[model samples]
Target: GGWPDAVTGSKKNALRRAIQYVETIIQTDISSVDNIRKDPVKVRDLMLSLARNTATVATVKTIRDDMVRGDADNALSAPTIYGYLNALERMFVVEDLPAWSPSLRSKTTIRTSPKRHFVDPSIATAVMRLTPGRLLKDFLFFGFLFESLCIRDLRIYADGNDGQVFHYRDANGLEADAVVVLNDGRWGAVEVKLGTKEIEEAAIHLRKLKERINTEKMMEPSFLLILTAGTYAYRREDGVLVVPLACLKD
Candidate 1:
């Protein structure tokens, strides 16, 4: 009913038309900015990769490599690529989930790279030309898209509460899909699971994160959440809330 539904014959045609409209806006902004080069192809390819993968923590080098693979003849220099990415971000075409680094009880090092996502999940699908049937056959990729969608919504809800959304990952490999933080220091951790089978593993990660943080320095989390694409919603005995994505509101 969103991007996937727009990926076919007529729907795709309409989507492309919309993209053309957006491109015009972007180009106009680039001209006004003056310092940034306007490379439509590179920016478009980056959008495709963002859609195809979930919220992959990406560096400038990784993105440049992707651009090279997408079109070697016109591969962009790293600095130029960085400029393009920054421009897109300024235009609200993409956003980053900065890594959360709470004072830890243990000395585990945390990854600092930001997880990259589109402002809306539809942008990725439109850039990638992914249809619903194609997504259904590729459950793994679909799961990533679902996670991106969850983060998009989480950002909205968190903003309403005067908070920001982040992601977490440590050297030991523990991770949380999203972390919501308020200015007063209260925070919540979340994991996005597209299926019931993943709920246990996600809950375990959230629990481990809570255990690792030094509560003396930072307030204990306001709550832990497991957002799902399934039909049911409930609270686990351990106090983690498992709510269907559709049920969430700001």
Candidate 2:
């Protein structure tokens, strides 16, 4: 069951009620936020896109075209879409994972695009009308939702540690799913993998990201971690800590 189950009181009616609830929240937020007009349709489309695609400038363009597809009058300019996104941020319905850049040995340019996510991953499940069985059957999308959950948890953990969470990607195509950096200059890189089978690949990416950093100007990473869907949490021989989502609690 998704968050809609909370209001619907039964899984049978949950998805319909949940979608209604999401729409209600969007409309309420938009009206309260001033002058955007009631564009829950727009934001709802956005939430759908956020769940299904990476939130990039290109995705935003897709959204613009999508709106215009239905009716040219419905077309929202990039600034308007961005404005609604900003309001969503204020309402805590959506958040973005900013990109991180450390001084590198080589001159590979960094990609500064922020990845968009819903504050509660459950909102995504609700909007998409996905149940546990549905998610299990679609492993690819499961990975994205699982990554969002990891990011949400890491943001909470980072807040307590006086740190912030970011994602990293460079022109050379190197990337890390999450980078936890503290105010005092210590930082760690993390990868979110839904299956233990993917842990090794994630670990390799984290290490590669570390090796790219110019250690003289930037400190070496404090740790490398991979959030996984395993039973027990343990440190691998290669130094990456494999943590099951269940173990990430106070």
Candidate 3:
């Protein structure tokens, strides 16, 4: 029963079994729900707070007040909050978007400060103990939340396709919150705003990006999108389109 060298006897079986076990653990443990639920409330709060300003820290007293609505002693410590958030991220429940630099010659450096977003916006509101009534009146807070949601949705969309999501800012301070780059290197610039009122800022930044990197070889996005709270999506004369946040996922 002499076998050829390529048909090694039990060695192949042992290697196959080991690989199966490793695959199971990698796919299951990395994003297990059990791991993320250890301190759901604390994790939620950290993600929500970071969504607004990543570098900002909320003290134990503040977190306690925001989450528990009682004495500061009940609040989670800052270190505890950070730990919970990091764990959730490891479990794929929260995603952090780092600042981007377009090119080396652009003079724009990547900012160390990152923007935090949750896999779901409801988790953020829940952690903040915010209700529908509170969100209705708190326009600024809701706006930020909506922007986060749009960013998340756009990211998902871009991921399924061959595109990248990035934020753009220049040395002169012109900035766009989100830039959608297609496979062919063509790009679409986007700005997220919370209001329906008239503001030309988004259009201004879109034009600045277009002007800075003018190229006829690559096609630009047909329209620059301004994701906002407006009820309907419409195009303005400046070539920027104002689209409601709802349109992003639609």
Q: How does each model score on lDDT?
A: 0.80, 0.80, 0.62
What is the clash tally of candidate 3? 0
TM-score of 2: 0.87
Candidate 2 vs candidate 3: the TM-score winner is: 2
lDDT of 1 by residue, 113-161 (tens): 8998878776676666666677789888788889899999899888988
Per-residue accuracy of model 2 over 1-250 as CA lDDT, tens digit each: 2453466476657666667767776668666876557577777777677667533323578766755666777677899888887777887878888999888999899999888788877778877778778889998888888888888889989999999999998888888888999999899999888877888888899889888899998889999999888888989898889988779794
Residue 22, model 2: Cα distance from true site in angstroms:
1.1
Better of 1 and 3 by TM-score: 1
Candidate 1 C-alpha error for residue 187, in Å:
0.9
Report the lDDT of model 3 for residue 163: 81
- In terms of TM-score, the best-performing candidate is 1
Could you give the candidate ranking by TM-score, starting with the highest?
A: 1, 2, 3
* Cα shift from native, residue 214, model 3 (Å): 6.3
- Residue 26 of model 1: what lDDT? 50
- Residue 107, candidate 2: alpha-carbon lDDT: 86
Q: In model 2, where is the ten-residue run with the lowest total lDDT?
A: 50-59
What stretches of model 3 exceed 4 Å from their correct place? 1-48, 51-83, 104-112, 214-222
Off by over 4 Å in 1: 1-37, 70-73
Clashing pairs in 3: none
* Candidate 3 local lDDT, 164-245, one digit each (tens): 7777655577777788887777678888887655348778878777776635545656558888877888888887888887
